[model samples]
Target: CEQVTIIIIIINPGFVLVHFDISPASTDDPDIKQMMAGSTLRKVKSHSWKKHRHFRLLEDGLTIWYKSRWAGRGHSTFSVSDLETVRDGHQSELLLSLSEEFPSDQCFTLVFHGRRGTLDLVADTPEEAKCWVDGLRKLIHKSQTMDCKERLDQWVRDWFTKADKNKDGQMTFKEAKTLLKMMNVEMNEENALHLFTVCNLSLCVLEQHTSASLMSPLLSRDEVWKVFQDFSADGERLLVDELENFLQIEQGEREGRAQELIELYEPSEAARQQMCMSLEGFQLYLCSPHGSIFNPDHEQLHQDMKLPLSHYFISSSHNTYLTGDQLRGQSSTEAYIQALKRGCRCVELDCWDGPDGEPIVYHGHTLTSKILFRDVISTLKEYAFKTSVFPVILSLENHCGLEQQTVMAQHLKKILGEILQTSLINGQVPEQLPSPQDLRGKMLLKGKKLGGLEQRSDETITDEVSDDEDGEMERESVEDLTKDTADSNKQSKLSRELSDLVLYCKSVPFHGFEPARASGKCYEMSSFSESKVKKLTKDGKGSEMVQYNVKQLTRVYPSGMRTDSSNYNPQEMWANGCQLVALNFQTAGLEMDLNDGLFRQNGGCGFVLKPEFMRKTDSEFSPERPESRPGYRPLRLSIQVLSGQQFPKVNQKEGSIVDPLVRVELYGVPKDQSRDETSYINNNGFNPAWNETLNFVVHVPDLALVRFVVEDYDKASRNDFIGQFTLPFTSLQPGYRHVHLLSKDGTPIPHASVFVNVSISELT
Candidate 1:
């Protein structure tokens, strides 16, 4: 068991390898001294009896090579074993191979951490992290002699060109470079060259394949998924509409339909594209949900339109014939003025006797503590507190009896003073009835006051005399509107009578609008000349409708619907307040024959105050006008009617077709009924045996939000919904704003009448 080893030692830094015989004498040889600093070493070409490497050392550097130099010295092979600094630098990886199979270390990946390096992956699944480093290392080695950018460009051109995807002139460098970068890296010529030379070359050598598939294409490793959360709806999946409503191209709307949307709100093109649609657009979007397939308007478009909660008026419950229940309670003075403050153009007040003989503005004949006549005056006085109010209330009113009538005048004199003489100048719901006796008493008084006793005799005599006088005037002129110059001698006498009656009647002093007081004296009666009487009688068909025996027609028809349009005398009918009348047209709407403005040019104010309504405003009731500096607009009292069909749900079953625009007015007589009932019949002919005083009616569309406004010449007096309602319209159908008709209480026992006639203007 003898072993002999040769060991050699050199005292120099230059590359060398020496050997000396090692037997029992050299058994203590150690490598520590050789590795120690300041150790001396000599260069030699080979070492005997070692591993496959022949170790070499020289001035350039140290290295190891394999050789059979012991038998044949000429056959020595060397491989750079290590290179350390400028001495090595990037040549580090090449020289630092750990084994003779270093070039085949494709399975081992190098990750550089500065001067030191770590072995990341070894022969397992692909180590993306390591590949980045390996690629970079190979890139650095390949470009060892060039500048950073120059080396990259050269490497890219060399590899990225031939690496063309279609073998076309165009190269897929971005894609290839992208993949090279995915391993914690990026693409450049250096990376590209590294990919082409190292990763690409190694795989080819190992797999022994040369085909187009050998190219490894990759994109940069990006942590986009970790950084960004994608909230967009997945394509072709069910996303809740509310959660993510993305509109489609058409969304069922015609191309131009969107233009309409632009007009209402600001809709931009981008918004339109994003399904940020308009209200109409929403309708189009939900058209399927609504199933209103036939709606040519908006309904056919947006399928999902949904309405808010429902609404109705408080007064919808009451259905009366005349809608008279609209006037139940007297408004507070504050309420009245408040109404005026809010732009009520006119107001109505019923005059009843106060404790004294003075007439007071009150609705009921008898007053209770809660309801007093003073309230009306009080409200008016307060109303005057405001200024420059427009369209002040010209009053429209009813008197219960001569007593109430006198009281009405007295109250007007008290509150309005001269305005009452000026404005008829002037002026929700509950249901109740007035006593029959009160009604009867009022009627007896009206009939007597409208008597024909004294005038009957005078009229008869004048009629006889005018026959002869006209014969003379026939040769002269039709000058004195009321005369007849028949015989030369009779003309003088007839002319005198005519002058004494008709001309004077226009100035009849203090016509009785108030309760007939006569200062408790019997009111005087005067006679009129028949020629004069007949001249102003209102039947003259030329320019004005002459008042005639329309009572017969009214009695028979009981409605304004006279089938014969030719016989309809509008001027006379309205002048005399005849209830029965006719219109040539049946249907009404925007197409209705309306002559507007105060006269008949625009849309006309339909009805005029009846003679009875103004009869009390004769010279006797005239008082001194208010002394305020400025004047008021001739008070505008525009009474409008909102039809039943317009009331929310009430017209549903009836299939109501109505204009959204409201039309202002008092209750209108429907176009059909007998003559007798015409005067008092409710528009629909409810309560045909009617007396407007006994039963008045008002029609409100809805109790909710119903606002009944009334003002005086100075614009005063406002009331409210009786108990509850938040709407502009409320219906207590068949009840009047009773103050406009009967006394404070509705009983017509002591009846009164207000005659109103309407004539639509037709330009000849």
Candidate 2:
């Protein structure tokens, strides 16, 4: 015998209100809100392929979904948060290629953050294109301005939307269990039910009837509620007093700031009037920028910029023309634009004579494609101060003859115009190199000069000059030229007009530290190969090198043997207080990651002030032995890996989950360089918890960079990289925090983070 039974569960109305309180992003622009209806545009992959695709902004206003008409069910989506900016008209290569066929007004480009490829789109009319461009810009601004809590709420809402397969706005126990698994939790049925029941009991009343209905089950929301209850005297709501206690005790916030937070985060008018916060309001407060892991005080221009140029480490790039290997690669102005956009204040240009008396920039004697020097100059003039207003150093390896060099000088003076620093700043030779603030919006050429600063502009003196000091030679041709110049003192004719433009950064031969200091010529700088610098540092000259860099500048570049455009670790050069440690900026790896991390502070102005000890001309600080330095204090850093959220899968195969592990690395002085990793969490990439602690003793916290790396654990072979984030140790905010992870190309991974507890204390 079988008896038919039906169970009905009713959810509390309060719970429903709280669950749906996650509102869509609001905008004053009606055109942006109308984007939810979508439009059909031509997606341009190249000049040949332009497919009609329907594009729509989701109701959340954060994501955009697009699909071709032929693809009935297949679609692609990207979040507005992933975009860097939007370019109207033919700003991209693909769009420019289509300019002959399509009007510039009908074209636009979507530039994504990091290394993500740009999306070129063509609208039916200029009005349609403007609609999309303006709407997307407004949405991107909203995404950027969202508070931390709102971002987390959006993140949770996105997960709920994905978990709700039937779109019923309610989740059953079965669906809840599936959601847990999808979130990378391997919990038993009993535990899952217990958690679900506890969350329901706290928020609503469940009644038995014919049908069962419950509010969506989000584990993060439950956790927030639990945290809220801990601070609430009566688990129903948090009063002003309770909220203040939580802020001061847990978040290290100052006293009397709770009321400000309540007014800012509380969504309900009644709650605001009563000075009380509901669960939703409490959750919002917890996700706000005040609760973020990164210290908000450091997000703006906080560092001093009045110091001399040699007192800071400048962000620089080598072979800025080549986007690939040194031998065979495409040299385009786009490479310069990308580097400049990334805050590279120093860019290298290898000039060779081209047809029609024009000079071209490329790797000399190599098969790399060439870009006209005039075009490059135009690009530099346009983008030099886009990302940063600091002075730009154009490191020119001039291999062109007199006529072509004169043409190069003409283009520089014509295109760059007033931005070019032709002579001294105050009509007097500077005792020290001018500060970045003093040289703001100025471009300085770094190349060979004909005569001394006091010499007349028309005076030209030929000298044996080898621009290969940084090992710019790639093939036998450059090597033979360098050999001939060295062996027979062969002299290359200098263009007097071009030579007059060289002022601050005159490339001079380096003999020894004693002679350089004796000359006291702060304007004269030298470039050394990475190998040469490494040898000098290792040969017991590290302290001397540090002192020498206090007034003069030193630029270190990669060895010529790196034909593949690989980069040496810039930290090694920076450790000696070398200002311009140029690296292959196109390569995405640990080297570039470290470079980006160091320059990510002080509003990413491309110059970071060196440590005090390294800046003092009379002080002695060596990277090899940091303990002996004055005011040396070793500190203990403890990081507790609590859990991960929405880790992107490294393997794209269906149903493939990752066993993720974390590695915490400390890069600085030799004594402080160490790494510690946590054990892998098997078969889970989302919401995996390790609860493991990694410790390090940092001897030079000011100079140290802490990197957090997440990788997919494979026991049979090498672990695959997932994502990583690196920041200076001084920038770390100690408390329970979330480390937002970045992709290999240094772009933020949407909704991906590792929650941890960080503590720093003086070593006993």
Candidate 3:
């Protein structure tokens, strides 16, 4: 059976039909090309759970199919684009655990994007592992470099392969109609036949006019022509007037830009001469950066990075070492790498004393696993600036003894070297904190400092203050270093080496707003639990909290009671002008969605400059009274939930189609927060059209975040999440736009999107 299967794969005519020459000839490496031949490898889920599986790369060069012998002919597949990277050798803990059984050179791991689990594999030979690793790297690069149009084309091709159940090159009219329904198009028979006839005629004309060699690839051009015909009145040519209408109505471009676009994107000289666009030109324009839903102007480092760090909302993570719940989670250096890669500027590390005089990081007195503090520091040094060049803040929750603390400090200094910010910039402490631009590529320690910078190095200072001053320790089951009793006031000796490393982000206890205002220490920051911050905000001290945050930085963290490692809504903290509002990065939900949305702007540099009103100390801009704030203006936001395309199946059971619905949510000032959803479209996940208009009156557009959520409607149970996309209202581009949907973990879902028309106008 195995020999027959190999022969079939080698000589199959269907392989040629499925293969697309998307990768350039120059990039066709021998190793990658060899991946078309299948191999057998051991898939390792754990030390005791390893089984042989047949693995093969498809002819498309973008997908991998794998199946176990026990599964018979059934197989599972994943796209190369889904992978974040390929790690050679025993880089992952799972691969490293099998070191005794498998040589390091024979193992590799495929790390996927978002929250997907890593795939660990052990090949029969070292050369086989290298072939897989190097081939995957080249394929990943090709996937990442594809433009918008290329990705869409690949997505369409993938769907076609799935629809071709017979594995034949041709599809009957009945098969084409079924494919349309599976793609979420609910057209009547008459209209569907008419459209299918038009497409068939378009392909026939292309095959007749072009050479035999070009006929095989004409299907892609036919798809583009179909889209062109939808917008063009003549169905053969797109004039400048029609192009202008598309730009204005579909692309949300202002009037009179059609001629410029034609000059810029038109590939044919005839189309350029006529001041119009062809089918190819239209596809090029759609693939351009300007055609994206995100404003292209904000795609780079467009924001002012010279502002003080406190004047910006920083992306942050709490319990950065944990991959799961705080109590029993596994702590690994990979957590730090993941956080930094996602542009988390501030990461919390709970350091406790470990064996061999090394400090370990984990939730203290819990079942959670521990990782060496030095390893976390080394990981940070490598990945801190990989995604963003902005400075990173190590929010250390130090509970280590003096001996291990010194070791921790030594490891940080030695491993990080020049990356650590051990002294004031320019050898002077300024009245205001330095900007992210000034501290680029630097890492600051956010923990207790022994004393003032003038204090003698030999002097011993008692670190008596607790950053978690709200008695969070008493709420959780985990034991705290300082229990809630007379012993709660007990102090630990500070290590001079560690204390000196805390320069810019010296951790201090918050007494009151008056004391913070009087001290005026821009470098001294405080950490407050979510409960305490909520109390302060609700007690009419919201204005003072904002004013205090404008000078001295304030960090808000979740309550210790949330042992599940859940997150508080960071927006509430942001509303109060909090700088470092940390949340559990390991958790995925609405809070994390909001966090990703807010930081998805300003080039995702981990810092977004606060609005002018939030930064001004005397502006009296309380989130509780947004209407009375300076420069306050109410805006009417209208969004027409038009349609969705290629929505993935929420339930993968056979013939299980989703009843999809679209929900538009507004998150901001309390009164401005609301949600409106369209009625569900029955048995249609592919191309559901709502065309329902939802209007919102945003009182604070600068702080408001608009979230579009699609769910599979269920009458008997809660709706299951399908996909969503969220962005700040300020970043939203008006006019007709396609909102590319993301999985729950915030990774892009290929070709899954919602088309909507947006308009925002000031409300009188």
Using TM-score as the measure, which candidate wins?
3
Candidate 2 on 432-488: residue-level lDDT in tens? Answer: 889999999999999888666765656667666454442222222333433444543
Candidate 1 structure quality by residue, lDDT tens digits, 312-332: 000000000011121233223
Cα-based lDDT for every prediction = 0.23, 0.79, 0.78
Model 3, span 24-143: residue lDDT tens: 222356776567777899999987899999998876677899998889779999989889999998877777667888999999999999977789999999999999999899889989
Clashing pairs in 2: 8-209, 148-287, 149-287, 149-288
By summed lDDT, which 10 consecutive residues of candidate 3 come out lowest?
Answer: 1-10
lDDT minimum window of 10 residues, candidate 2: 1-10
Error of 3 at 764 (Å): 1.5
Model 1, residue 470: C-alpha shift (Å): 30
Model 2, total clashes = 4
TM-score of each: 0.20, 0.85, 0.87
Candidate 1 displacement at residue 463 in angstroms: 24
True lDDT of residue 210, candidate 2: 10
For all the candidates, what are their Cα RMSDs to the real structure?
Answer: 45.5, 6.2, 5.6
- The residue pairs that clash in candidate 3, if any, are 184-687
Clashes of 1: 154
